[model samples]
Target chain A: MSTLRTEEMTLNMGPQHPSTHGVLRFIVRADGEVMREAIPDVGYLHRSIEKIAEKVGYHGFMPYTDRVDYVCAMFTNQGWGMASEKLANIQVPKRGEYCRAIATEFNRLASHLLSVGTMGMDIGAMTPFTHAIREREMINDLIEELCGARLTFNYMRIGGVAWDLPPGWREKALAYLDHFEPILDEYNALISYNKIYIERLANVGIISADEAVNYNLVGPNLRGSGIKWDIRKDLPYSVYSEFDFDVPVGKGEWGKLGDAMDRYMVRIRELKESVKILRQALKQIPAGPVLAKVPRNFKPPAGECQIRVESARGDMGWYAVSDGTGYPWRVHVRTGSFAAMGIIQKLSQGLMIADLVTLIASLDVIAPEIDR
Target chain B: MEAARIYQRIKDRFGEHVLEISDHQPDPFIVIDPASIEEVGSFMRSDPELALDCLSNESGVDYKDRIEVVYHLFSYSKRHGAVLKVKLPRENPTVATLENIWKSANWMEREIFDLLGVIFEGHSDLRRILMPEDWPGFPLRKDFVEPTEYHGISTVRESPIIRLDPKKK
Candidate 1:
């Protein structure tokens, strides 16, 4: 036998690849099946959304916020609305806050379903995706009835929500939640505990709790790393304080504590928590006006404020500065996906090339969310 | 810890570096000298009482007169947060990188660099995170003028309403 020489090769994974979930690219350095590093080359979907906020007045920016993270648009809407409300010191009516919470929790369910479903699909299980999407489509229909649009539901406003819950909508939402609760077990049976899926994700791309917090991971991602911090629970934002729900953290049942499977399981567990929140919100929602009264030209005092919302992906931070003008002086959205993407190159070291998809899906890094 | 108490601690530690504290109605912030940001960041992160472990949000604003970089520091252990700002001259806004103290600042500084043209000295990987590498100017800057065209591709599209004007036809 003769000795052979080899060199690492470079490969481009996306920019338009099926497993990426959105327009994301990865410059992968590979030696055979294992990767040396997978550097994320993002911003393919950059839409200058933050700049647009400076041009459009505060109220006009609500619709645009929905596009920030279409998978869980309600949180983005709530984040922007909360930021503006904080800047102006406008109090959202109790009913309106309930509406916001109800709509956002439903959005979280839809988002987690898509995430878990896509994780299965990314790992080569196709049937579970159809099942998850089937449940998600129903949520879409319910949200569409609450707000005209489904994906980009601009259901929130600076003071409160755009409208009150539609006629008999609470009963319909409750019915949907009732039907959706049992489906979690079905999903688990189908995919979550599948032998091959566990083999693929277990003990892969483990991020310690300290690393998660140091990287500024939020929402489910932080929980996945065994950090029991949820913006809704610990920070106590909006009606989240009023609603009773459990915050689920990953236990590493089948793998290392902070591995991909742990992240996947955290999202699955959160789907249940979201259902619980929705149940409480729908049952306990008080009767009153949803939209608060405000002047046509809405401009807050010259001040800076930031609002944190527990979006499906993670903790979404919206920092706004108003120079006492019709339009905001500056608006910046520090999204979870952007922070998640930052850690990919570090995590991708020494992983199988195929497992890169697993890493990205586990983090649930949506493109628009990263770019915005 | 309360923001005012945190300010007092920082002031006691770094007297000259702490420029001013605006005890505003909501979200009071401490303005620190750009030169001492890294020192303050490390102090805020390591000090047990002020264990601001997570850099929750970092953003840059073009105030026309000056460029301000805002850091929203949060502590998961203590469950409290503080806002810090560094005002740099508009012409060449530069600040020391906080990436060493808080890993989250790596990408955030790059974003500030990309969008606002603020330089983060000693950043390990300082490149455009959102905009293209060769984009003309920082789009987030207040006085930035969008290029009429990029790479010979027209940035502007003719409005259909303008094209459909009967008077022009």
Candidate 2:
């Protein structure tokens, strides 16, 4: 008699799994509860964005950027606008810079809220996720009032914002900030201290500073591994340097483990710093022309340039090569999510199958950002 | 370190391999030869003064005569950036891979390969990333000709064609 040996069972985790978020699929070869190999299959949400940029004019391409990283739409808008401004040699007005700073910081808060909150849900803690998203909805309401849409708001224009702050916008935003702090405290108390959550994330995905640098990881992922690098502080493009805020590095924050838990804590600290930036921006903003005086049909000279901005995810870069025309010859978005996904392939190699979702959530891999 | 200082160091280090160093409005770029890319790249990454630890981006631009491969490297420790360019002949465009230095270069090189058809000499899995497996010529190249006939479907050509009729006018 001969016994048949079976290979590891292959399972598909999603092109539509709720935890996988945004059209992402994982081909997992597992033995019982242990994952042997996890192959990430992308391109489901591919919009051929680079090719599309070749067709659209400079300013017309702004709207498409909002869809690239929907969670942090303002950063996407700011990155594209900054690249265009650099190419055209146009200066943004003081008022426009202040407004862009505020909008981008607000979007940062929203992106981190979803990242940390959904992270809790993935780790089997349900209440914190509900509480965190409830706060995010309030911010979404403000974004909707600013732009017509709740999500994918094409609000940032090339030279400035689409429009100035509406009536009572600052007061309402301040009220939301005041309301959000206590809830964040509650989240820290609820999930950050939970033993089960701590065990799963404490040292699970520990990427050292050397490995993080080698992989070119950015944002909280890099910081979490004890690298004191934040694009906002290191290479400030807009009015970020003028503001007073801490670039939270996660070396000794939570135990000695620079792992997934450290990344989660760094995000929480960044949220507080973002709030501080918003407060200073709201106080010192001078009233003047919100839009810069740019030509109706703007055309930059034939040249190639690259601009990098610190988004909520990480270093969001836009490389535009112009051909002395209204449209760009080529545009490439170096998205942070796409960079972070590279690390996951290495980190998930030895982990259990159950821990995979938690690891994915911790990385905050937005699929459109990856697919685009 | 400032952009000017880095430009000077790059010029001093790789004398002739450095094609042109310019302090443009946005950033500074050093254009170099495609053959010595790996040596120059290793120096940029490991040199204590120019610690470009992070490979920010890798992309390809297709000019009419040649294909240009661009590498954007940023040093977080020193808070400086430099763009490195390498040009290759369009006929058989090839460059050494930097995957051994920075792991993230893996995907970006694949992207360049898929779009511009530039072959990386030592890439582990050099395949089309964004495009389909059995796709035609690279779409981003200037000389890329769209298929006029594929799978028995003939696309209508815009050029005028001479006709011979049974009854001449």
- Which prediction has the highest DockQ against the true structure? 1
lDDT of 2: 0.85
Clashes of each: 0, 0
Measured over all alpha carbons after superposition, the RMSD of each candidate to the real structure, in angstroms, is 1.4, 5.8
i-RMSD per candidate, Å: 0.7, 1.6
What's the CA error at residue A133 for candidate 1, in Å?
0.4
lDDT of 2 by residue, B66-132 (tens): 7888889988778778888898999999999999888889888887888889999999978876666
Query: How close is chain A of candidate 2 to the true chain A, as a TM-score?
Result: 0.96
Error of 2 at B53 (Å): 0.8
Let me know the TM-score candidate 2 reaches against the reference structure: 0.92
Highest-scoring model, lDDT: 1
For candidate 2 chain A, the 10 contiguous residues with the lowest summed lDDT are A249-258
Those runs of model 1 whose alpha carbons end farther than 4 Å from true positions after fitting are A1-3, B162-169
